[model samples]
Target: MEFREDILGAPYEAAELTLRPDDEGAVCATLVRRLVPGSERAVLYVHGYNDYFFQTNLADHYTALGFSFYALDLRKYGRSLRPHQSPNFVRHLAEYDEEIDEAVRIIRELDGHRQLLLNGHSTGGLIAALWAGRRAGRAVVDGLFLNSPFLSMPAGPAVRTVGGPAVTAIGRMAPTRVLPSSLNPHYTHSLHKDHQGEWDFDLTLKPAEGFPLYAGWLAAIHQGHRRLRSGLGIDVPVLLMASTRSISTTVWNEGLRRADAVLRADDIAAQGPRLGRHVTIVRIEDGIHDLVLSGEAARTRVFAELDHWLAAYLDVPAIEAPLIDAPLIDARPADARPAGESA
Candidate 1:
């Protein structure tokens, strides 16, 4: 794992990690890092589906908080995508373990970081929670931060129940079969500079119309959701943040900029407690699906909530971090299901 200057350029370095080949022939994941001098703690971030490690502002925020930052572009996505591979295809969510384990080893053992925090957004959030749960009591990670984790499907329970087995069976028979995508392009428009948003990332890597959704991939995600719903007993402190509401629309609307355009915040809040006993669920008003990418006022609240939580839970000294404002809802849902209950 030799580090080289990343596509993001100076001060941000990237390393290519070779993993055991899968049905796709060869596989790899990229680890991008920006180290803060003499920082004892580090953060490992995983981006959502159709996304990569391009949030330099996020890295800047962590570095400002005195922690080194790293991001992973998982196999078949972003920097790790290869010419011969199907975009973002995986038979099982557990397949991610290989790269995640390697990244953790490099961060903790090779880099000599004393404390580690795992941060994930959207689908990455679900992956992080499941990974943390599987490694519960291992102490490999000190804290978990989820930004609008896709814990449950956006559809009603009936649709999930009826479609789950069908998708799995179809996935088994034709793993690469493409499924019709309902991914809202407005979300992409809401984030990219060419549209209504302010960020400038590689559109080819995270296209306005995302990569095809595969049956096998959806099946794997369903399996992961089931496992999470059944409970993995993650024992570490977990900070789960999501938008206060989700806006689902076919046409472009200004509201898309202020609310989550992907996963539902209600679903995320409902499943927050299932993560662990020490979970802290925060709802940021006017926050987008990726809380960090929200508008200025909302992003400020998101970071403030994170800072307050970290100060209380991770032993990070609070630099006069103010109490959470009223716009931020910092409570578990009243009807939160038990750890082992079916969602």
Candidate 2:
């Protein structure tokens, strides 16, 4: 249900963040913003590939937490796309730093919120994590919330290891070359269009025929993945959420109802610690690829876990800083034990 209160009641205004052509003469990134009237905390959400900010409810969730939400539809994705540029194509993930930096500057100036949180989903999740790592000790972010982040190559090792290089090379050479993909009618059919699915985002804008996978995009992703796997010294606390099981992008099945079908849950569990300081990995039972967007029962379970984490982290009183400036750990640094213990 829509909150009865007037959202972003005052002074808050929606604005656009624009960048001009670099030496390449290609204008890039138009960051979008909708500031809260009088809210203090701000959240910047980055969406996954083939995704945009249609989940208005998620924005509401953050508003309820007293955070004004702003979502970025990256270059060549969603509202940021122009006629000339290709959709969802990039050679280096670092190239996105410009857009992200622009967004941050806008949020800080407009809302002036001390507590800034970064939330991302799927590929967006990876982007946010990498951004946070880059900003470590820079006093840029308060915490990070990654929901079912796509950290590793979703495709199996064989294709990903071999095909990835090929895709990157091809993308760089001829980014316009169309790749083959077949839609799974089952998954598409099940999504509630008006209510349950509750979205009619333009396929043209976010095409069912996803944009090409040029070498630039593939190479950038490989580079980003490598950085994530190497580990970042994120100074802030983090929460990583995922489904209890892995569901394939393969055709729909009753099993799809209960698993993350997109990302391997084990990957999330294994890499949770690699993210940063004091990380918590919560697995929601029966959750789908996007837990918050999951079907009925799983959705409830997903929110339940979210509540538990928030209560423990955000809701409770802040712990007083210890007299001595030191960190306590059950394990030593550079020491990664088995999954269960580390997580």
Candidate 3:
């Protein structure tokens, strides 16, 4: 269906873009800050599994820091949806290189920004890390920021070791096939309609579907884990943000609101160093699955840390932290896009 106020349940009208692969067909996509001019630096944000970019105020977060912000609703999600494609599906996560490269190409070329900050959440975090480990990332961006990113698999030791390998191998032979029960309901209330969060995205695109778990996707994630755990030779710096704790996706409780109820924060805190030379790890106590989208008090902490860290490292002066207080861009609850920018 079309990405309308009623259809996508967004806080703003999403602008559509097509990322055509040099080697394959064009993929559907979306860019958040196309109309505004930008600075030498820009952030290209990628969303996690069963997700898309909907929060415009998130764009303002960077813009307020004097950097232009650009977020992509990657293929098969948000405004990029296709009738035939799954919400989020792939045999290998590396296959996303096309979308990543093209998205950067669009931002860098169109906005002509010199520095590209690749920001992501959840699975998108893993994708960003893997991409930054590549040669392109060496020359493309200045840094990376991952929010509640999924690094190592969250399964138990036995499943992670034996079960993962066996299941992944079976997946390659049957890429399009679905694994049973990909969705976990325990965390659903955290993002439901009555939730306290600031976004109002469509559940269909974001899938409340469990996201199909085919063999290729599992193998791709495992490959990323191997590469990251083995140590990536990236030259740029990386910032990883996670909740102070973790809760299982299967266990429903208030703890899910206060901690990352998906991936293990300790694993990320531990493995982040292997991703590159310059790595900074920040843990948000009582943060939710997506730190930025956590409760009010939690968000305050999230922005404080972000502001302090960005100033100390990027040399950016302290500006107002990101909040949902700017002008309304659409019909959803509350969202804003930061004011003017460079280029």
Candidate 4:
């Protein structure tokens, strides 16, 4: 793996790792880094569906709090996508173990970071939680941080109950069959600069309409959710953050900018405790699906809550100036069950 200046430019570098290929052909994953020299702690960020590591400000925030930051674009994603491969397609979520394991090796063995935090967003968050659970009782990761994890289907539980089996059956027979996408463009509109937002990222990497969702991929996600509902026994402190409200709609509206337009926030909050014995849930009012991409006021509150939580639970020193002066929206411990019940 050779690291070179990334598309994001100076201070940011990306390295590509070759992985064992599946039926679709050659595979690779990209690890992007912004190292803070001599820092002993690091953060490994995983992007959600139709997303990549383009959040420079997020890296900066971690670096400010004394950590080397790294983000992974899993196989067939952003920097790793090749013409021969399907976009973000995996028959089983465990297929990501190849690159995530490599990334951990590089961060801990090569870079020599002693403490590592696993940070993930949306679908990536689900992957991270399950991955951590699989690594339970091992000291691979120090903590887990999830930003709006896709713990439950946005269409609600009934659809998942009835459709999961059908999707899995179709996936087993024809894994490559594409399903109609349910992604709304308004969420993209709320984030991209060309639209109504302030951030500018490569649209090709994270298209407004998103790529096709395969039956196999959806089936894999359903399986992951099932595993979460049954409990994963993740043995680490966890921090789960999301907006207080969810707004699911296809049409563009001002509310899309301030609320979660993807997964349901209530479902996320309800499912978060199932992750581990020690989990903290925080709800940010007026925040979008990605708390980091929320408006200024809400974003500040999100960061403030994060900073305080890190200092309180993970032993990280708090910043001198708090990001927000308002009362925190919510901070509660999850009553974890040995085995979780169905949603």
Candidate 5:
């Protein structure tokens, strides 16, 4: 493992974990850490599809609450992407277990953190939930937090029930085949400072058009969703959050600035309970798919709810400032939106 300054630069460190490859050549995973010296509690975050660990505001929020924060950019993603590997491609969702295992080992044994929290967004959320369930008796994680977890196909019931099997079959026959996707580029536009929002990140890693959705990858995701639907039985307290509403549109609209333009919020809320018995769900009004990256007002609410849940269920102490008020480490000019609107 080699530590280096992250893309956000200064104070933040990213550790590269090299892993053995399976027919795909060399691969690696990056552990982005905000080291709070002597901190016993830590949160290991996982990013969603076509995303990475550029959310320094999230790390600051956790650090302020006295917990060290670490985010894993899984193999073929962000800092881990290799020139020889397919970007964000995986034959099985379980393939990520190797990286997650190594990350948790480093955090628990190497770093000596006793209490570890697992936080995941979108596809990462599904991966984390499944891993926790698989490790149920091992007590690897103390709690789980999911932001807009992709529990089911956003296409609705027919796709999940019928089209799912067909996709899986195609995946087995030709795993590398690209699948048709209807992702709207406007959602990306709404999040970047260069476009319509406040955050600045590498468009190459998380492009506005997004990486191709391969048949194998889609099949793997549906399989994970099936496992989640059957119930995970994750033996830890779980906090699930999503936007109060979902707006699916191909064209840009003001609603894209507030509501989730990715996964269906209702789907997230409905399937959250299947993760465990101690699951609590919160719906943030006017929030985006990634709650932490939502507008200031929405993020404030998200942090408040998170703090309350952590205090009550995980026995985490309350911090004076539940949310970070300072500007993001990588400060960028805030793009003006309509009055009362926030991204």
Candidate 6:
């Protein structure tokens, strides 16, 4: 494994891991690392669907808390995307086990880090939880941190119960067939600096329209959700963080800037406890789907809560507070809304 400067540039580096080719062609995974010499603890992060490791501030936060940070761009996603491969396509969620296994091996055996934390966001959270459950007796993971894990279908029960089986059945016959998608561009708009948010990233990598949703991929996600619901039995301590509220909308609205426009926070909170016996759920008021990328105040609250949990559970020191550069546009008064509208 050779390390090179990451796409994000200085102080960040990535190592590529070539894996067996799938039907699509050659595929690989990239492990992005930010290390401080002599740090005994490390955190391995996994990104969600249509996402990559562009949150440098998150790495800085973990570094401040005395932990080395690493993120995995799973095969066909982000840095691992090959020209011949379909973006983010996989027939089984377990297909990721190879990459996760390699990442853990490098962190534990090669890097010599004694305590390792598994951090995952959205779909990544579901993947990590399932892996931890599978590896419970092995004692490889010290703890688990989930950011708005996709516990269930965002659609209500009717769709999940009725449409889920139909989707899976079609997926079995034609795994690569694209399915109709309803993802709104508003969430992407809320996170990009060019649109309405503070951070900037490659729109091509995580486009507003997003990559096509394939039947097989959706089926894999459904299977993972089923496994999670049945009980993961993950022995490690788990911290699940999410926005306090979820607002569904097809049109642009100020509420989309403050609340989670992606997954329902209630679904996450409800299913969080089932992941393990020792699961702690924290809801951040006015935070977005990705808590780390929320507005200044909410983001700060997320870090503070995470720091507190780490201190209590892992005996880690408190993180020295840093001045936030992003403006808290979402921290407006409760009654605040665009003008000319009457409630």
Best by lDDT: 1
The parts of candidate 4 lying over 4 Å away from their true place are 327-343
Off by over 4 Å in 3: 1-26, 34-38, 195-198, 249-251, 320-343
Using TM-score, give the best candidate's number.
Answer: 1
- TM-score per prediction, in order, is 0.95, 0.80, 0.83, 0.95, 0.92, 0.93
Better of 1 and 2 by lDDT: 1
Global lDDT of model 4: 0.90
What are the Cα lDDT values of the candidates? 0.91, 0.68, 0.69, 0.90, 0.87, 0.88
Q: For residues 1-343, what per-residue lDDT tens digits would candidate 4 score against the true structure?
A: 8999999998999998999989988899999999999999999999999999898888889999999999999999899999998899999999998899999999999999999999999999999999999999989999998999988888746888898899999988888899999898989989999999999999999999999888889889989998999998999899999887889777889999889999888778888879989999988889999899899888888778888888987799989986665555543323332346321
Evaluated at residue 329, the lDDT of candidate 6 is 27
Q: 123-240, model 1: which lDDT tens digit per residue?
A: 9999999999989989999999999998998887899999999999999999999999989999999999899999999999999899999999999999999998888699899999
Worst 10 residues of 5 by lDDT: 327-336
Q: Give the alpha carbon lDDT tens digit for every residue of 1-343 in model 2.
A: 1112222333223344566554334655544445566877788889987766666667766676566777787877776677777667776777678888878877786458777778889889888899889989898887888888878876666977897778777767865566664333344334447323544555565554466655566667777887887897788778888876775655547776677666677666667788886888867666676777777666655555555555576562322322222222232212345556652
Per-candidate clashes, comma-separated:
0, 6, 9, 0, 1, 0
- 113-208 in candidate 6: lDDT tens per residue? 999999999999998998999899898999999998888889878999998888889889999999998788989998999998788999999998
* Candidate 5 stretches greater than 4 Å from native: 321-343
**Stretches of model 6 off by over 4 angstroms after superposition:** 320-343
Q: Which ten residues in a row have the lowest lDDT in candidate 2?
A: 1-10
Expressed as tens digits, the lDDT of each residue in 180-295 for candidate 5 is 77778999999999999899889998999998888989889879988888899998999999887889888889898899899888777878779999998877877899899898
The residue pairs found clashing in candidate 2 are 168-215, 171-214, 171-215, 172-215, 192-197, 247-261
- Candidate 3 residue lDDT tens string, 1-343: 1223423333333455555542224566665552235467778888987777765556667776777766777776676767666556665677677778766776687558877778889889988888878853448777788888888787665777887677667777776666665456656567665553445766666656466666666777787787778887767767878876778756557777788777777766777778888877877767877788787777777777777767766676876545433321121111122344211
Residue pairs in collision within model 4: none
